[model samples]
Every structure is written in C-alpha cells, then in structure tokens.
Target: MLEIHQFPCLSDNYGYLLHDPDSGETACIDTPDAAAYLHAAQEREWQITQIWNTHWHPDHAGGNEAIKAATGCTVLAPEIDAERIPAVDRIVKHGETVWLGEWDAAVIGVGGHTNGHVAYHLPDAEMAFVGDALFALGCGRMFEGTAPQFWTSLTRLKALPPATMLYCAHEYTASNARFALHADPDNAELQTYAEEIRHRRDAGQPTVPSKLLRELKTNPFLRADNPELQARWGHPGDAVATFAALRAAKDTF
Candidate 1:
C-alpha cells in the first residue's frame, strides 16, 4: 500500500508526500515549499526520491530546484508546461504513465488552470493528485484555457471511478461551498455537503481529498453539462457556455 503524508504549507497549499514503502521511494506531489517538504520528509524518516509536478505555477513547482538539489530526486512534469517548469527530468503527456516502485500513475491533462496542467492518478490507490484543477466544490480559474477546453478536461476527471479520492492542493472548500450553494440553491445534497464543509472548517480540519462521488453531485463547475445547470446559468444546452458563465461569475464573486 502507498502511504500519503499530507501537511499544510504556505498559506493555503497542501503539500503531499507519496511513499511506497516496498521500494523505499517517496515522491513529492508538488513542491509548494521546499523547507516544509524537506522537514516533513526528515521527520518521517522518508527520503524524497521523485517530484511529480502538475503545473508550472510557482507555488506548485517553485521548490523543485531546492528539493532536487537536496535529494537528487527525478522530476516529472507536464510536457506542455516544460518550458515554464524548472528542473524537469521527464516530460509526461496525457495517457503517459509514471511509476513509483511497482505502482503506476496515469498523467491526465487538466489544462484549465494553466495551459499544461496535469493530474496524476493512481488507479491502484484510488486517488488523484489534482493540483488546482478540480477543487472540492469548484474548479480552477480559466487562466490559460478556454471554457470548452476546461470542460473537456473536467469531463475526463468526472469519468474517473466514483470511489476515487481527489486530493486537491488547496484548502478552499469553505469558500467554494458558499459559491456552490449560490449556484445550485435547490440541490439538497449540496446543502448537506456545504454544512459539513462548514463544520469541518470550524473544527480546523482539512477538507481536501474529497470523494468523487460527492463532487459529481455537487460541484457546479462539473455539472455544467446537466440540463438544470445549463438552464439555470442561461446557457440552455451548451455545457461549455454554462461553464464559461459559472467561471466568470465565480471570478467576480
């Protein structure tokens, strides 16, 4: 079994260290903070051996050089964003596979947040390291891709097994829940889920690693194709248009 060590670093970023004990290989999902990642690995007595970068964002790949220099780990990043990311030893495209011991992770192209954003999905672990692509109740902003492209990216994620656990990189669930409720005011499941998110935040607990089953029913961004959402957002039958409207609204909201 792969062991994941999650810890808070920076202001809202969640650092993930994926460990495969059988091969003694540890991979940093993203290099949000080098010092924090190094300290966390040291405390757990795990040697960092690889880095899997999801995008070119500074917060996601800023610590790459430092961590690599310290651990001599190999860095794998999205091929499309290779020019922007630092110290990438391997550039992986969508459908390509990366390995940690005997376990394999598929690279999923999720290019809305950034033009080359990618997600690492481990089918065996039933989890995905989704760096700012899909949030608990929201998706990343359309920084570099079109709504159609982003919706397409999300469609791939929505196709994942319902039991898949989404390990998003931020702690934005509370705020996202607020927007989700506003977007889908009549969704009873969303109301319940929002309330749970509130309680989780009040207790100072992390709301990441959300289940795909719950998100499928609640995340407005992911529900753009639903007739109700398309009608509600005034897009009628266009999922891409509806997604565009929702993203525009959230940017100002």
Candidate 2:
C-alpha cells in the first residue's frame, strides 16, 4: 500500500506526496511550490525520489528544478509538452507505465486543459492524480484544447473505477459546486454534496480526493450527457455539444 500526504501550496493548489512504504520511495505529484514540497518531505523524514508532473503549467511544474536539486529525484513529465517542463529527466507517454517502487501507474492522456496534459492512475492504489483535466464538480478551462477534446478527456476519466479517488490539482470545489448548482439546480445529490462541501470549507477542511462515484452524480461537467441536463440546457442529445455548452457557460460563471 502507498502512504499519501496532501498539503496546501501556492494559495489554492494542493501538493501530493505519495510514498511507497515497502521501498521507501516517495514521489511528489506536481510542484505547485517547491519549498512547500521540500518542507513536507523533511518533516516526514522522507526523501523525494521522483517527481511526476501532469502538465507544463507553471504552478504545476514551477518547482521542478528546485525539487530535483534538493533531492536529486528523477523528473518525469508528459512527452507532448516536453518543452515547457524544466528539469524533466524522463518523458512519459500516454498508455505507458511508470514504476513507483514495486507499484506501477498508467499514464493517461487527458488533454484540453493543456494539449499535452496527462493523469497518473495507479489501479492498485485506486487513486488518480488528475492535473487539470478533471476536478470536483468542475473541470479545467479549455486553455489549450477544444471543448470536444476536453469532453473526450473527461469521458476517459469517468470510465475509471467508480471507487477511484481523484486527487485534483486545485481546491476549486466550493466555487465549482456553486456553478454545478446553477446547471443542475434540481439535483438532490448535488445539493447535499454542496452543503457538505460548504461545511467542510467553513471548518477549514479540504474537500479534495472526491470519489468518482460522487462526482459522477454531482458534477455538471461530467453529467453533460444526462438526459435531464441536456433538456434543461436545450442541448440536442449529442454529448459533445452538451459538454461544449456547459463548458462555455462555466467560462463565465
């Protein structure tokens, strides 16, 4: 089993440190803040052996050099955005497997947020580190790809095991929940989930690592194909069009 640590960084971003106890191998997933990652590692007496970056966004890969300098860790990044990521010791392609100690994680290409964005899925761990592709009740903006591309990316994510735990890069759940309510106002599950999220935030707790099952029910972005949502939005039965409409609405929401 892997021991994972989640910590806040760079105002709203979250840094994940995944440790494999059997081999004492620790990997930092994305680098929102290099100092924060270093501090967390030092505090736990763990040496960071690897860095798995999901994209080339500054906030996600900003600390690559610093972290590698500090720990001499091998930096692995998506092959598609290799130019943007610094200090990338290795390039990982989609459908390829990367090893973390004795465990392996499959790299899934999830573009749209960034044309080359990728997510790491460890089946044994039942966890996925989705950079900016998917989020709680929301999804990454179409900054580098089209709505259809983002929709396809999200579809792949939704196909993960229902029990999979999604570790998103940011804490945008509260705001996403508000927008989700706007799109799916009559969804009782969303209403309940929003209330719970409100309480958690009010108490200064993290609402991340949301369950795939829960997101499937409450996240509007993921429910674009739902008959009720399509009808409410006056969208034809096309999933791509439905997703495009909702994504456009979210851009301004």
Per-prediction TM-score, please?
Answer: 0.99, 0.98
Deviation from truth (RMSD, Å), model 1: 0.6
Please write out the lDDT profile of model 1 over residues 135-175, one tens digit for every residue.
99999988999988999999999999999999999999999
lDDT at 115, model 2: 94
**Model 2, span 1-253: residue lDDT tens:** 8999999999899999999989999999999899999999999988899999999999999999999998999999999888999999999988999999999999999999899999999999899999889999999998999888888899999999999999999999999999999999999999999999999999999999999999999999999889989988888687888888999998998
> Which 10-residue span in candidate 2 carries the lowest summed lDDT?
233-242
The deviation in Å at residue 218 for candidate 2 is 0.9
Candidate 2's C-alpha runs over 4 A off are none
Q: Best lDDT goes to which candidate? A: 1
Superposed Cα deviation of residue 61, candidate 2 (Å): 0.1
